[model samples]
Target: MPRAALPPVLGCDFSSSPSRRKPVVVAWGQLDAEAGTVALQGFHSFASLAQWQEFLQQQPAWVGGFDLPFALPRELVSQLGWPSDWQACMQHYASMARSEIRTLFKAFCDARPAGGKFAHRATDGPAGSSPSMKWVNPPVAWMLHAGLPRLQDVGADFPGLLRRESARVALEAYPGMLARELIGRRSYKSDDRQRQTPERAQARAELLDALQQGQHRLGLRLLADTAQLQTMAADASGDHLDAAICMLQAGWALAQHAAGHPLYGLPPGIDPLEGWIVTAPLSRP
Candidate 1:
């Protein structure tokens, strides 16, 4: 039996508090499943969550891989006595104030042993992502708090979280998973101008090269013009590169779907309360 064709994909680098200084960046592109190629069409940056939500609402019929946690740890959710169902949990989560969330998470961590304070989602280990409950030092929990609701509001489909929407599918993405596979902890881009040195720039170049040459096991090559490459390389914040990596992940997910792994390679029986990360090795079905 043959699988369906792939659709357009989006890769988003989100911010909990987007502004002109650090806007949410979205990379739009298409994947050639047969050719195993992904092309970067362009980028869009939104300085406000409202604007981001508006764009998502306007753009229909595309699969998106967003660089944000889609759910919190089951352990954390259970301890908090929140709803166990994903949609219900998200609804409960979205209704809370940020201060309330912070206080609860803080107390949760404060009571635990120092080294084992943060509860982790199953995806966190494979994705090398920070615990979604952490309020600082990456604040992925805040990202989830800010980002997931927008997807829900727009009626986007997220496997195990929301009912499948035929037009708009959303998947959780982490660029670090793919980046680490290529460079093995080599720093690529830094938000701090002082930290964005020649070495990091070179690392970015090397990563781009690896993708172009199809060095990864996914065997997907990235296609971008010289100008686009320069723009991605010159961004000191690395948001552009992260978005591109996420786009590739979206493409991979599409390919996985086309190959008959309908859940985009996410394992069956995964905790519905803790959604899986796309392409994470531990997430293989």
Candidate 2:
């Protein structure tokens, strides 16, 4: 039988408190690994979470990458006696206000040593993601708090946690991991004007060049029209480029699924309470 057609893929650069000044940016694309290319379709920016929610509901079936933690640290869950089940745990988490989350997570950190302050999911280290419990300096905890409920409400299925008949499939994505692969942990874009130096801009330019030429391990080049490429490059926030990275990760997962890996390129036996990051190498311990 011929291979089934792949769904349109997306990558999201989400904000916990989205506003006109800082919106959630989504990159839509198509990745053809055999052809060694991923074409950028366009972008959709949502000024409010409700706007993004509406987009998720109205769109056709898709496999997308979301730049947020899908689940919390298993150790944190066990320590706090939150529900061990993924859905139940999220329910417990979402019920709290951001202030309450800060207090509790801070308390958890206070009791531990400085270097080992945060409880971590195994994938955090391998994927080089901030702990899902972090409430500030990226506030990934707030991201999960804000984003997961929307995914859950959309009736989307996450591979490790759910396997229902659904039009949308959601995977955890970390653009920094892929960026590190391309640029080796170099600073790229910045939200702060003072921090957005020429050096960071140079890094972003180089990353785009490498991605366009298929210079990375995934062996997939990015192909965007000149205007779109300029849009991604000009935005010093890096939101556009990050979304593209997420799309590439989703594309990689889609290829793995097509190749018969059940977890859609996620590690086998990933903790349901701590979902895996897409496209992270299995070789990392």
Candidate 3:
């Protein structure tokens, strides 16, 4: 079967803190007909962890491209001396509050130098992601600390987690990795009413064009109509939409796993579930 006919379940735009900020919105699309090609299927915006949890409970299984880092490096895990096992380690980490995680990571970074404090993967910079464990700036470190625990609590069927005996929910993804390759340092989103400049709009438009053309190695194309791309670009806050596009890119990479990519893509000695991104089952536990 062709990639497009595989059923539409991937592509997610996430809010790192859905409980406080706007909900995570997922836009799903696929090639609809034999000749018509990719079409927008449906979109879902998750309001709360509970709402996402509910979705997971009902859906059982489908791939999603979420905006969160999928896994922390094994080197960092060992340095922290957290549980070596994935599940136990994540459970332990999840029990702590966000402030606690910040303190822990902050203390570690303080010991190192400003130049070498934060550990990084070879892929981090290309992906335009904050250090998976950094608490400051983008605060992705806290995000993993915040997001992973919830995934554990929900106990979705993560073959990746089960395989590694780690409950961390490991997923290897960074939409920016692909996005920047197409448009470098091009600002495409803003929450500030004053900063929504024409440059940003042009950036968004260019990105949409690139995606439709399959400019990235996605191999598959985004079969959106011109109107759809314009609508998505028009949203002043295209961050979520950009994230959704990234998610879709990641989803394509994931489907490739069936053919050759690593099923979990966890680094050497890392547990599978520790950082995987997944769709919430449609029903709640």
1 against 3, candidate with superior TM-score:
1
* lDDT tens per residue, model 3, 149-227: 6555556434455543332222445556566767987777776879999998888888877877767655556766656
Please give the CA lDDT of all the candidate structures: 0.89, 0.89, 0.59
Ranking by TM-score: 2, 1, 3
In model 1, the runs with Cα more than 4 Å from the true position are: 1-5, 283-285
Tens-digit lDDT string for candidate 1 (1-285): 866666788999999999999999999999998899999999999999999999989987788899999998999999999999998998899999999999999999999998999999998887788898988988888899999999888888897566665678899999988989999899998888889899999999999899888799778899999988998888978899999999999899888887888698677778889988988876422
lDDT of model 3 at residue 170?
27
Cα lDDT of model 2 by residue, 1-285, tens digit: 987788888999999999988899999998785786779999999999999999988987888999999998888899899999999999999999999888888899999997999988888777888998898888899999999999999999799987778869999999999899888979998889999888998999999999899887777788899999999888899999999989988888888887888778887887788888887765463
Q: Model 2: runs farther than 4 Å from truth?
A: 283-285
Once fitted onto the true fold, the runs of candidate 3 whose alpha carbons sit more than 4 angstroms away are 1-7, 19-21, 31-38, 153-170, 258-285
Lowest summed lDDT across 10 adjacent residues in model 1 is found at 159-168
**How close to the true structure is residue 259 of candidate 3, measured as C-alpha lDDT?**
52
Candidate 1 is scored at a TM of 0.96
Worst 10 residues of 2 by lDDT: 276-285
